[model samples]
Target: MNTVIVQPTGITPADVLAVSRGGARVEISDAAMEAMRTSRALVDDIERAGRPVYGVSTGFGALANTSIAPERRAELQHALIRSHAAGIGAPMPAEVVRAMILLRVRSLALGRSGVRPDVARALVDLLNAGITPWVPEHGSLGASGDLAPLAHCALVAMGEGWVLGKDGARVGAAEALHAAGLRPIELAAKEGLALINGTDGMLGMLLLALNDLCHLLTMADLTAALAIEAMLGTDRPFQPELHAIRPHPGQGVSAANIHRLLQDSQIMDSHRNDLVHAVQDAYSMRCAPQVAGAARDTVAFATEVAARELVSIVDNPVVLPDGRVESTGNFHGAPLGFACDFLAIAAAEVGAISERRVDRLLDVCRSRDLPPFLTPDAGVNSGLMIAQYTAAGIVAENRRLASPASVDSLPTSGMQEDHVSMGWAAARKLRTVLDNLTSLLAVELLASVRGLQLRAPLTPSPAGRVAVSMVEPFAGAPGPDVFLAPVLEKTRGLVAGPDLRAAVEAEVGPLR
Candidate 1:
């Protein structure tokens, strides 16, 4: 990937993904650098005037009324970062922290935070050097943005925190910076506050989840096609005309994808005229496109929210065009928090309906005469009975996670932040929800492919064959049950991957 130029505007989800995961380099545009200079000059003039401002001269949070002399103003910034680095729990994923750093850079580059140009450059350098700060999972209520988490990221730049080592172990920030041919920065005036006060953490995770969930939603359609072919379910419901009346964009797209995947299928062809084979399939079979399409729509909605947030400067007390430094609630994470929780609900429902499909494929009566539990000898070998159980357990967990985190608010900073967004917690839960959805889809894929294999004389669709080919190694020939854990475990990795979609898409053009 080429270097991502950070301007005051035009940042996108793709840029974030590139820098966060694709190792793309970041640079501030000349226009942005000039804007920063202009903004900083105003701050310099304000500091010289010796007037009380929310972030520049006075204290922060509950102590905003406390006036400070010029000499101690630099110390105030340092102390803000140090005191707010109160996060506790396991460290966030390396990608998440990298994304947080990238977004903070973007915010500063927007020239609204009133920080010197080097503040943004130092963050860019840390990202280019791959120095991931150890940000704890907890501590952000999401009102004044992700304080504790971004504070940890700020601490690394100040040479006062820990970073992930070459071996993924925790190493001192000073040592990591020195090894990376970088020097620590001393934050002055509003620089440290600018670094930490934003919705970067939750917003970054939300973007990552949307990226990953887009693929999983595709897999949801892919696996649904596999189950339809394996169970000899009819594709009449997926007809373009049937979906045309409803006119939901995602529903039509999903229905078309399933229709394309089911083309030239011997199974669907054999039962094309056989009326009693399945009069009308169950809702799980009939509504695969509906459920999966809803998820795709939710991803679209969340992506829009993330897109707007990507270019937005979420810093407090932003520097205005009129040379006025004023405090604002632009740092509230409610928009992001609601988006995160909404996607989780959508993903969990996809997993919910996917679990139902797996159950149908396992039961002999419901599976159109695929063997009980998908084993050659039903009574002796337990087969994939427990795989469904594992999927069910995950689906249950997803239900609990689906409860919106945005509504659960607890005051922090001694009620100075009386209401919180809880967006960070929602973002964390969304990651787990997507993880569970991937595993559940894997279970469906494993069981449904087994069903396809049992019906040997009747061949499946070409895309179905490609799916079977992918899972065949883990799911050997119709036989007694081996250690099923490793099979499902490895298959989960496959479900989370892109190869299956690529192979199927290669055969059938492309899925939605």
Candidate 2:
């Protein structure tokens, strides 16, 4: 993997994933280095002025009114890091920690936060060295920008906390730093506040979720398309003319994708003019684009929010270009919190609708003339019966997880930091919902492909045939349910990626 260069310009979602999940190195640009130096001078000037500043000279949170002696200023930074590293629950994944560190590093490099260049450089080095910090799961209330999680992340870099070993055991931070041929740097002046006060954790999760959803949503479209043909339903609702009147960008795109995928289909032609099939399909088959499209638009909106956050200066008492240090509300995570919540609900809706199609495929009454549960021996095999149940189970779980975390809040930091964002929880729950949705879509794919195969001489669409090929080896022949868990798991592995979409797109041109 290539190194991700950090500079005054900006970073992208791709750069974040590269460093976080791909183990890529980071390099700070000279311009960013110069900017950091210039900002640090401004902080030095403030300290020499002997005036009280929020983070540089005084205490934090409810203690903001207290004045700190110059000698104790360094202790303030250390204390802030140590005290705030009070996160609980299981440790965060190494990738999540890497993303938090990278985003924090990017913020410091922008020259707004008054921190030494070495502070940012040290973080980049740690990222490159792959020495991930042991951040806990349940620390952030999402206010003050993931303070607890970021604190734990920064702690390992300061040689005072814990690191996750290769085998995921907790190791001494100092020992890890030494092993990596790196030394931990002490936080100076307002550096501690700058390091921990960011929306990096929630924003990082949102970005990763967005990338994953992009592929998964496309997969959703394909799976929905397969289900429509597998159940011998008409594709008229997917026609471009029908969607153009609505004018929603996502809806139009999804409609066109299904319309194109259903082209040159022998199965659709088999029922094209038959009075035998219902004039219209059920809501799940007819309105997949409507639900999935709304979800796509939601993702678009969240991406806009994440993009703006990428360039935001989210530190307290930031160094202004006009030479003044001022506290700010930019660190509030409401924007990111709202975006995460929106995506979570969208994931739930998509999964719920996909589960409907999965159930339809297994229902002998609704699945056209297909056998009950797609089984050769109905009552004897109970074939794929619980598979629909699994999809239903996930859809129900997602409904619970879809409840917005950002909507809830509690007072903290002596009530000075009240009205928290809870964005971290929102983002965390979004991840789980998306995971469940990936499985839900996989179940749909498994059932639909089996439904199409059960049709025998009645061929499917060209794209649907390609989709069957993608899952056939893993799906096996539509038969008795012989240990179905591995099959669903294998199909989910494909459903969670771009391979299925790519394969179909290769033959059918492209899906939206």
Candidate 3:
């Protein structure tokens, strides 16, 4: 794989994915190296002047007023990293830690952290050598820049903490570094602060979550189309002109997707002129565009926030070109906190609406002509009945997780770090919400595909046919349930993976 170059500009979420999950290499640009050199010179000048800088000379947090001698300043930076690397609980995923390293390197490359080029290069080398730091998941306040987690991440580079080896065992950082043929660097003035004082940890998780949701939301549109066709619902409500009256970009896009997905459908054509059929479908079926569209808009807003964060230099006591360092509140994570909470709400709502559709599909009275629980033999075979319950349970959990973590704050660092942003909590729970939604959508898809099969001689839309064929191998032919957990697990993989979406897109083009 080609190396994902890091610089002051043009860092996309795809780059994060590439470095974190794609097994790609990374390199810092020459422009960034020169900038780091200039900034590092400025920091050295400030040290020579002997005036106390917030992070460069003075103590941190509650001890900011204390001054330190030039000889002790380097020791201060090392102590800061050691003290702050107080994270607890299990280590974060290697991919998350890698993205944190990548984003932190990119932030330092912006030339505002006043660290040496070798400091940035060491981070890159660690990433290339696959020496993932054992960063704990629990110790971030999401303010003052995910201090604890980033400190733990920085600990690996200082050769003081543990790291995950290639065989997945936790080993000493010194051993890991030696095995990779790289030696750890001792702390220099402001280098340790620059390494750990960043919002990169929380931001990395949020960016990856945002990217994953983009694909999942598209899969949602495709799955919803399958359910609508399975239920013998009309697609007239998805007309572009009808959606145009509302003027919501997400709504119009979702409506257009359903419109394309339902084209050339014998199933829909069979019911077009029937007067006895209900004129309008339920809100879950008829108003899918509105629900999923609103969720799409939410994701778009979060993406915009992540984009700004990608380019931003988030640090305290940022270095200036005029040979001065200033302590600033840029390290606060409120923006990412709100964005993560907002996306969680949207994901929960999407799952809620999807579960309702699943309920309607399983309920005998509401299913139009399909049998109860989508079983061919009624009570004798309770096919997929419990699946609806599972969806409901997961959706309920999402609702609880959707409660905004940003709104709740607790003072930290002896109240010197007061008014912290709980962005890490929001990001962590959002991951759970997104994961739960994948399973819920898979259940809905499985149920919908079964419902379509029962429609019999009436062939579905081209896109619906493609979706059914993609899911059938895991879900198996429509019949009484036999060992449903394995099938549902496979179907969940089908829903979460790119295969089902690729099949649908091959037939009906890409969904919104």
Stretches > 4 Å off in candidate 1: none
Cα RMSD for candidates in order: 1.0, 1.1, 1.3
Candidate 3 local lDDT, 211-278, one digit each (tens)? 88888887788788888888888888999999989999888988899888888988888887775553
Model 1, range 1-512, lDDT digits (tens) per residue? 77889897747788889998899999889988888888999999899988788888888999999898899999999999999999998888899998999898888888888999999999999999989999888889898999999999989998889998766688999999999899999988998899989899998999899999988988888888889888888888899999999988889988999888888888888888778775799999899888888888888898889988988879999998788998999899999999999999999999999999999998988888788899989899988899899999999999999999999999877889999999999999999999999899999989878988888888888887887888898778779879888888888888888888889989999777
lDDT of 1: 0.89
TM-score of 2: 0.98
Which residue segments of model 2 deviate by more than 4 Å? none
Candidate 2: global Cα-lDDT? Answer: 0.90
| Candidate 3 structure, TM-score to reference | 0.98
The positional error of residue 107 in candidate 1, measured at the CA in angstroms, is 0.6
User: Candidate 2 — worst ten consecutive residues by lDDT sum?
Assistant: 473-482
* Cα TM-score of candidate 1: 0.98
What is the alpha-carbon RMSD of candidate 1 to the true structure?
A: 1.0
TM-score to true structure, per model: 0.98, 0.98, 0.98
